[model samples]
Target: MNDELRLKIEEYLGGIMSTSEATLFEQEMARNSELKEEVILQKQINHHLRDDKLNAEIPENEYTRRIRTYVKSDEAAHIKQVLKGVEKDYKERVKKPRRKNLMVAAILIGALLLSGIGYWYTSQATPQELYASYYSTNDLPSVIQRGDKDSKLAKGAVAFQENNFELALNYFSEYIESTSELDPFVYIYIGVINMEQGNIASANMALDNAIDSNTLDSSRGLWFKALTYLKAGDTENAGLFLKKLVESTTNFNYSKAKDLLEKL
Candidate 1:
């Protein structure tokens, strides 16, 4: 089957198809024996993939070997060529007595293996661990202060800079309470702190508030909100926000957003 049909089958297997799409697909499957057979094969693959007993039957190294054994001839040839290039580069570096190049090549290979393994492992990671990998507070603004350094917002900025998240959140909350409409960055900081505190839903709400503001850094709110979803392991919402950022031509993170959307 074509890639579109194959993806539809996979989505059906994953139970992600919309009701209308599923109904149409089911009707199509009734009339197409090949589609029905492919669906069955996909279901079997999914079953084995998720079966602890089937997975535990073979050690990881044996599974790796099995996967290698099935690599197409052309793909194998391409991989061999890539490895040969690395080998040749390493030998040349050794001949020149430049150890750094050899180290770089070894690192390159290790990174390839790690990235492939990491992708699979990341998909199965808990929300907390994923958050640890992706969540980081943005740098503090550098503009001249409009308020006194002793002000609550200023104290919050200082606390945030020092990584004292709770103190920062409290100070920002005080400042927000005293102001008619606080800076968008205040809500962003509050959201980040809430996320670090394991209050994901609260963090998202704070970020939504930030995004609805009229501040110059408004687009950054969307970026951080998408990141919040990513930390929560909600790829669908993360992709949605990232896609939005990519579509916003004036956004500073547009290119990065596009790259991240592709990865998701």
Candidate 2:
């Protein structure tokens, strides 16, 4: 591709294009298969570059193995040659006034080559793997001792902790039906139980209730909702909720949500 076209592709993928510009670009891509291919290639390159800093720490042999496994096209060979040239230029220009740009270019090219492996691995991760990696019940509130021990909420909490999801759901349902003043946390518990049972639609409904509760811990619902989508392999929807969680520093699991968003 020409340098101008390449730059435009980069800008488009970087989300720097205005809506009208992006629409025009999409129209152009639809009419030009080569342009569309270039755009896809640029997206792959950007995906690999997103975690460049982390890829820098990988051992060279392991990195090379990964690259060999995932990248076999002539384009990859061209990228290798370009990276070598950038490295050579960087070494030769280390003491010059233009060293900064050379350094950045070298790093970018090196990362482009190395990080494809990481990107491939990330892309290969199953939705179940992602869910298992991020999901945990440890942070859930302990409701066993709250209020009366004989209360339905307390029984539900105990059942949930014991992995008796069916019993927990029953007790939680009873608790909800008995009260005009709903405990938002109970909805969260219901959501978690339903999610564990693979009832995605029901889980989402309960989570929605928790969010609409407008209570202090309402943000917790966002995190669980993201996990629900992740478990269901609906990463696009998962990202929506994760983005909401990361918008406020005080939001539950804000840092984790931010990290997960990057992975997605």
Candidate 3:
């Protein structure tokens, strides 16, 4: 590769490439296996170069200067010799070698524990994915009073029970417009319907209304609101609600909330 292309690759690996340039480069990589391999190799080298803990006993500037000088030089054997000398010097200078060994051991142990924890975390589904796994219309409040005989509210409840979310939502909307005393459960139903349809923001707004109305068990509203945030991958907000649910013994799903909080 030309010097300009080499420098561009370096810049890209360093994350300093402009958005448009990065987009173009990614498009190029899609078509070029050799370019992709070169980029991956550069990234691996960059990772080692960025690790400050690599040669902790060496003075930062002196070690950096040695590395840069060796890399820039054309003499490959000289580079190996210099690196060996650097390592030997660090080992010789550490008079308390046993203490250094203990410190290194401690670091290694901590790193292993962290790596295990990270693997466990990443191996599990994300909050959004977990929400999908746990979610069910059965969790929603059952239609207790199907309203006046053959009423829109009754029809909406039937549709909701039948899993026809859109039709249920439409019926509920018409009922809300027709009635003066709006049932808070209607808002809860609407919110849940929106959530099932993946309309996160709308679900949240309706759940908020349910909470503010102070009708229908507001704890259920809070629980569903938290689930809405969880489904949308807003774990911060979801955690807040989950914490609240855990604190409230009266919430129906307190145990489930506690379980979800532990995952977060």
Candidate 4:
């Protein structure tokens, strides 16, 4: 590409182009396949360079110099050609309006780049980072009125929703000890609380009890167990549980487990 076209692509990718300019540029890209490919290449290159960990590992000037050199190499040319093919196939298979097509084109290129870089990203991520990314209490059972507000179960559930894990644990423990026929979900609450507190062994034991309960929600424990292992950086064990989760479409977080399995 000529220097002026390259500069324009950079400006567009950089979001420095004004509204009218961006609109015109998109129109230009629609008519010019080569411009679209160049834009995709630049976006991917920018993404790699902007990665925090990558920037930390390599000196700024040196990394930029190396990346610029690679961008001008035969390997990058081959990649652009491959991207061109991907765009062509994607366009042929899916029909959408012009603006939506442009958006999908960007997304498709991003997905392609992610596929290539996913392993590197996953490997570099700390176990804690992965856990933080996936672990959420929002989906957990919420407080329900069990007729008596003073009941241990009600108290525990309320505390859990309030983020008072310590209080919740105590209430949950009391509830478990008070009954022979325990609700399997009580064990899940305890497991999640323990896991949040970094009590991995206690968390695993509680989760195991939930799983072994064989209730309708037993599969819920499996998902947490996978996450427990993931939080511990035990990818092998995590993958095993994640695989089990994906076996049934009805399993809790089946699609999410499948996606997480790919990362593992």
Could you say which candidate leads in lDDT?
Answer: 2
Task: List the candidates' TM-scores in order.
Answer: 0.48, 0.53, 0.51, 0.52
Error of model 3, residue 178, in angstroms: 2.0
* Per-residue C-alpha lDDT of model 4 across residues 74-172, encoded as one tens digit per residue: 989998997998798677757545775666557546545544554465455666677788888865655464437888999889888889998999999
In Å, residue 173's CA in model 4 sits off its true spot by 1.0
lDDT of 3 by residue, 1-264 (tens): 678877889988778999999999999999988887788777767767888455333335987999977777878677688689879867775655786567655654654454445435542679878788667666776555655747887788889888898888889899889988857678888998888787987998788777767654677888898888888888767767776665546675888877776676
Clashes (backbone N, CA, C under 3 Å), per candidate, total 0, 0, 0, 0
Task: Return the TM-score for candidate 1, rounded to 2 decimals.
Answer: 0.48
Question: Which of candidates 1 and 2 reaches a greater TM-score?
Answer: 2
Question: Residue 224: error of model 1 in Å?
Answer: 0.7
lDDT of each: 0.73, 0.81, 0.76, 0.80
Which prediction has the highest TM-score against the true structure? 2
Task: Give per-residue lDDT, candidate 4, residue 246.
Answer: 68
lDDT of 1 by residue, 1-264 (tens): 799999999898788999998999999999999998898777777777878354333335887786877685686888788789879976876788556555655654654454455455334556446546545544324312857888898898888878898888889889889989757778888887776666888988788787778676777878887777877778767766765565556774777766565565
Per-residue lDDT of 64 in model 4:
93
Segments in model 4 whose C-alpha atoms lie over 4 Å from true places: 1-124, 143-147
List candidate 1 stretches off by more than 4 Å.
Answer: 1-136, 139-146
lDDT of 2 by residue, 1-264 (tens): 799999999899889999999999999999999998888777766768785443333335887887876698787888799799879877776656475566555644654454444345455566667888888887576677577889999999989989999999999999889999868789999998888788898999899889878886688999999889888988777867876776567888889887786687
